[model samples]
Target: METIGKGGFCKVKEADVRVFRELLKKSTGERVEVTGMQHMAVKVFNRNVLKGQKTSEFDPFTGCLKMSDQLQSIMEEIKVWERNSNPNIVKIFKLYNDPTVPEMYLLMEKAQYGQIQIDLEGGDYLTKRNAEIEVVAVAKAGVHWPQGSGTDLEKASKWIFYQVAMAMEYLHSELKISHRDLKHQ
Candidate 1:
């Protein structure tokens, strides 16, 4: 595994896992076996950061302050991701919790282009535009609607704005959650 990114409380690493595929029936009724290695991103949370923190923070969703701060935050994030089905959102494959381990692991889908923050820092104008386009494209790809073509920057900007607005609406109205820290990164 190789470290790809790191934040205050989490470190992201790139890893490959071998997965076995069962035999599948082909169109011609013949059995075919396939197996391959899948690339994934492992987000390891640093539990030490929450070691001495108070656990009595009030939770709006639960209407109670019963759970530990660390566990509450982790559970809330997992719940949000579990309820989210948006393609634009990074998918969480699995969560690992072990008694012996001090930290938790979240196995997630690897983004091909990487974080937008790094791309923007590279000073490429098209990188930001492409990132927005990619996000909008993924968000709208599942819907059955006629989407016009062309990579116009103005159009892309509008598309990105509208997509974000819709996502906010979904989170607020549908999921009853508010994202306080919203940023391009």
Candidate 2:
């Protein structure tokens, strides 16, 4: 079986439940449940594009989008956890390599709750009231200050900015890698 995603990659059926379950146990070092299982994504790389590819810096939105290269980028992201640990970042569990197909599968921790970013900013997705309610809830959750006194939103925002800057500083100065894309999302 095969499946495709918009502007992404192709995927083929990798394994059935029994084999996959055993594979997950071996990889994760723990018994786990895999649900909504589907074909693993495989990048289709172009030789012509590879010929001129010399830089790591590339526009993610436009011009000769290479799926294979993007998969490599994702792999690099997984590798970063080996060196640095950050609570804000997502954890990648394992990497599955299929020599026959030349495809890699990244098994990651699945979040039971839907992404807040998608809930809030998903295209034409949030209605007015929903946005307002989410904003209020976030605002309430964000408050922190002197023992009892509640901090203002600006203060909270500044604190968040500082924490993020600290993380970037550590990454750049210590890890020697630039985040490149740093924006409030």
Candidate 3:
């Protein structure tokens, strides 16, 4: 078996880098490089391409889907660790994709530290020790650090619930926007 790196997946090699670059070129038509060891997660979408006008794919009033819509949806989500703007939110960043390989590449901010995944099958899994370590690390990293240092279990849980509620409230009370998937990983 291959040795697992700190990121949990198999160690990423030079070939992996090449493949990723190729994918980006094919998808967004841009040549880019992975600048650092930080985790800059990239998400690619396989949305339809229409040459003409853009239109809403779904009805605004009713939450329904239609088969006859001319436009197709191809949206991808890429999240990166950003400098801390808020204590409650971990980190968020914006990315730009290569226009040529538009579907393939999204160059994003890199987060030096890894992420913690909460398995939903069981109860809360983050131990106090881990929380304490993360808190201290963030504290030492300084408050103004643009790419925030870290987040604890309590903050993450609260943020998730709040974000979900706000999203739901927005859907019901504000403009209609469809979110196809909402998975943690």
Best model per lDDT: 1
Worst 10 residues of 1 by lDDT: 19-28
lDDT of 1: 0.62
Candidates arranged by lDDT, highest first:
1, 2, 3
| Candidate whose TM-score is highest | 1
TM-score, model 2 to reference: 0.46
- Judging by TM-score, tell me the better candidate of 1 and 3: 1
Q: How far is candidate 3 from the true structure (C-alpha RMSD, Å)?
A: 10.5
For model 2, how does the per-residue alpha-carbon lDDT over 68-185 read when each residue is reduced to its tens digit?
A: 4545565465577456665544344455554455445544433222233333343444523333323444464575333334345456556556656788887887777788656443
Per-candidate Cα lDDT values, in order, are 0.62, 0.48, 0.39
Off by over 4 Å in 1: 19-37, 54-68, 119-151
Q: Which model, 1 or 3, shows the larger lDDT? A: 1
RMSD score of candidate 1 (Å) = 8.9
Per-model TM values vs. the true structure = 0.62, 0.46, 0.33
Q: Write down the RMSD of all candidates, one decimal each.
A: 8.9, 9.3, 10.5
Which residue pairs collide in model 2, if any? none
Off by over 4 Å in 3: 1-39, 44-57, 61-64, 68-71, 75-103, 110-115, 118-156, 159-180
